[model samples]
Target: MSAQLPEITFDEYLNEQLINSLNLQTNVIQNLAQYSRHISFQLVDIKNDVEILANRVIALHQQQQSQFLPPLQMFVQPSIPPSNSLCFFPPAMQVFPPLHKPFFSTTPDLPNKPVPFSFSTIEP
Candidate 1:
């Protein structure tokens, strides 16, 4: 003899489905939250490392500038003009044209004759 199964009502079925859906959504939200927290921690670490690197770069730049550059007083001091100096300025700059011919001019010219071409109708 075959055993008969009890009929499930539509309302009970719907409630069960809703619960499953809510459970799935809750798990997804929790996973996303955990992932976001992980990313945020990484970002925080990267920020701190970047800040330290930037500080080091600034210190190195300052040290190099101090080693290479002249004293600040020399730039600040005003120089006296010589009595024999002429108010003459240098001549204006001149622009020279390109030495070689353009690509289009270098290429051989096309023939004067019209190109022969025929269009055939495609049959279905």
Candidate 2:
């Protein structure tokens, strides 16, 4: 004996399809909300990492500045000659002043200039 199925009206079929579509839409919305929340968390982590790196860079810059010496000032004597002197002295006596050895070396070793080279053939 074969079982007979009941016939559903067109309105009932359309209603079922609409309910399924609504359910699918609801699922998609939920998934999008979850993805948005995950992205926000990652952004927060990245922001924190950037802040840490910036602080380290600032510290390094300050350290480098401290290591370097301040600007040096040259000592200049007055241009006026002594009352006992017979001749008038120049306005400036020394143009470049010498540096102390304790703080810095006066002479630093520098690389020598490169010499020109040429190829020549020799007889055996």
Candidate 3:
């Protein structure tokens, strides 16, 4: 046997539609709130990771300074004309400064001899 459907008035039909629309709006707002909370949590985690990496870099820099190691500094050769008075090192050798002599020449054979490092200007 088929179930008989009840006939509703026009006003009741409009009310039902309004209620359904409100329910959909509520669901959208809840979903948006959940998404916002998830994004905030991820941002906090990223912030903490960046802070930890920054601290590690600072510690590494301190250790390098205490051991008389070369602090990472960019060595740029001036674009002036090459002369005997000017010292111009290539890009490969420019990274290490002459101050790191002891750490570099720690070999047994060269115990007494100091390694010669010259940054002579290239003739162009």
Candidate 4:
């Protein structure tokens, strides 16, 4: 059997409408918060992947530069110009000084004077 209840007044109806509006607004705010959290998580994952890719790209660029760079070349023989050859006088003037032979030779021209040498000091 249905029980008789008192009719809701105009003030109570207005209050009920206000409460429903407030509940709907709260539900909307909660849904927006959940969506923002989901977006943040996705952004975090994307950031990590980007960082890894950036590091890999840097390593690859370094490797490429190393491979393309040329090694320092060293010459086996020293390449000296003809003018750099050692001489007592300048060749452009072409002046020849009188040659004086050394007083001593392999035959020992100063045998009587006796050339002082370390050979005499070295004991056999």
Every candidate's lDDT: 0.58, 0.62, 0.62, 0.59
lDDT of 2 by residue, 1-124 (tens): 8898999999999999999999999999999999999999998888777666755654554454455486335677667667888786676764456352222244232223322221222245
Candidate 3 lDDT score relative to the true structure:
0.62
Ranked by TM-score from best down, the candidates are 1, 2, 4, 3
Q: Quote each prediction's TM-score.
A: 0.56, 0.54, 0.50, 0.50
What's the true lDDT of residue 25 in model 1?
A: 100
Best by TM-score: 1
* CA shift of 105, model 1, Å: 43
The clash count for each model shown is 0, 0, 0, 0
* Predicted structure 4: clash tally: 0
RMSD in angstroms between candidate 3 and the native structure over all alpha carbons: 15.5
CA RMSD of each candidate after superposition? 26.9, 21.5, 15.5, 30.8
Candidate 3 error regions (>4 Å): 1-4, 69-124
- Output the better candidate (3/4) by TM-score: 4
Superposed Cα deviation of residue 34, candidate 2 (Å): 0.7
| Residue 58, model 1, lDDT | 49
lDDT by residue (12-122, candidate 1, tens digit) is 999999999999999999999999999999988887776667556545544544564452332223345556778633332223343433334543432333222212222
